[model samples]
Target: MRAGRKYFIYDVFTQRPLDGNPLAVVIDSEGLDTAAMQAIAREFNLSETAFVLPPKNPTHKACVRIFTPDYEMPFAGHPTVGTAIALSEMAEGNDLAGIFVLEENIGLVRCAIDKLNNGLFAEFDVPQLPEQLPLSADPEAIGAALGLGPHEIGFENHRVSLWSAGVPYIAVPVADLKAAAKVKLNNDAWVEFSPRKSEFAVASAYVYGRETVDHTSSFHARMIVPGNPSYEDPATGSAAAAFAGAIMRFDQPTDGSHRFWIEQGIEMGRPSRIRLEIDVAGGKLAAARIGGHAVRVAEGVLLA
Candidate 1:
């Protein structure tokens, strides 16, 4: 067991504790091997756990390794936000507002931190521009995997689309919030629809609708990764990042900076809110950003 390793627990995308997705961050993971880190992630049993290490580049604040119980991710949203806030809080004599760069598997991500009335807020520019993938599964197959009827699968011009910013997800637009809330993944169907050897192995289904719990929100969403420790994630930043491609494709927003508020995790009782900002110029996506609040819940040392 590696003794004296510190960690913090944070509820991400929400101001209050235990309301949003929970993240466990090992403050300094310099000596831990990959297997040890994976063991720590499983021990935490959260949707994702982060290991913070000194940056390889002097200009970056830190390098973060994100892990689900099953695999290491190139990047993840909440962990990035939570880790930044945690680091900022730890820095002595630092102003509340500043920019920090973090190195992740995808690339270097720049995060801006601000102290809001609710809590510390962190927002980061998407490290990679979301791109549409040629891969797609049948609507029927997708519906079956999600326990939805074919009729409820898509809405308006939106259909099933595969997109990735850093991580990939199947963006599924449903008819309404009610339909979005009722989603259940059938493991067998999902395996059949998205085979293990296929590209969808790393992809999860992200269902969303225009209707939202908060009137100020632009969309309501839910994500289900069938075999993960947390089958349904309360909030998914990566999915929201990929969703920018879907928005540009279906909504066709005019040239300008557009802000979208997304409500997610209501069905699981862990309601979370995510802010997505997209900048367009010359009818092309110039950049995108994801932001939200996080509150520290607990802190402890890992005996192992």
Candidate 2:
């Protein structure tokens, strides 16, 4: 049997412990296979788990593999941010302020780290710009899937749209926070609404509303994956990455750098705040970045 591997648990996207999304980072995953990694991720039973491996490129710091309880992800936001902070802390006493490239399935992601008053702060540029996918589910079908009426499925110019930065998600805008909170996934309806042959076959529905708990927050969001043990994700950086396109397409922001705060997981009692920044030039999206704080909560060894 292989020797025990060390793993750290982190609460990401929040300053305090137990407030943000929980992540398990397995260090020294050099010898583990894909099946083992997937099992470890399922063992942790969090929204997502990360496996840190040696970088294929000499210049990159590390290659990270992200796995949900069900499947491996090409790229994920919390794992990227949390892994950077964890590695920075592991290299404590060294200069942590700089750019580090993390090799992911999507590509090499450039992450910036800095020492903060609360803890370590990490932000990474979206590996790919959000691309719009053809909408396959209509408002009525989407509403039925989410146990909402057609009227509650969309607000203003915002409607149901499919997008992806690295992973795909169906973005559904609601009229108010109450409407967003009322969403409950009807699995049967969802399967019918988004079939396996559809473009959004493996996508989650990201329901959001303009109203937020925090006045500083621009929106309140919730993500529900049909088969995850945790029915609702506390925080979702990948979804936010794709949301940049929806913001640009609908808000029509002027040419400049714009920042927005998204509040999520309030109902689950693990409130998480995500910082999203978008750069626009001549009314076109130039870049997108996601930033957040992660606090180390626990550390242990995994015996497999």
What lDDT score goes with residue 58 in model 2? 89
The superposed Cα distance between candidate 2 and the true structure at residue 14, in angstroms, equals 0.8
Q: Candidate 1, residues 1-304: lDDT per residue as tens digits?
A: 5699999999999998889999999987998889999999988989899999999998899999999876788899999999999898888887667998999999999999998775789999999999988765788788877878988988889989888898778888999877897799886667655524223254688899987888999999999886633288999999999999999999999999999999998999999999999999999899999999999999999886
Candidate 1 — which pairs collide?
Answer: 2-304
lDDT: worst 10-residue window of model 2:
193-202
Stretches of candidate 1 above 4 Å error? 195-201, 228-230
**Candidate 2 lDDT tens digits, 1-304:** 2768899999999988989999999999998899999988998989899999999998998999999877788899999999998888887577777788999999989999987765778999999999998877778888888889987877779978888998878899998988888899887677665534223245788899898889999989999887523288899999999998899888899999999999998988999989999999988999999999999999999876
CA lDDT of each candidate?
Answer: 0.88, 0.88
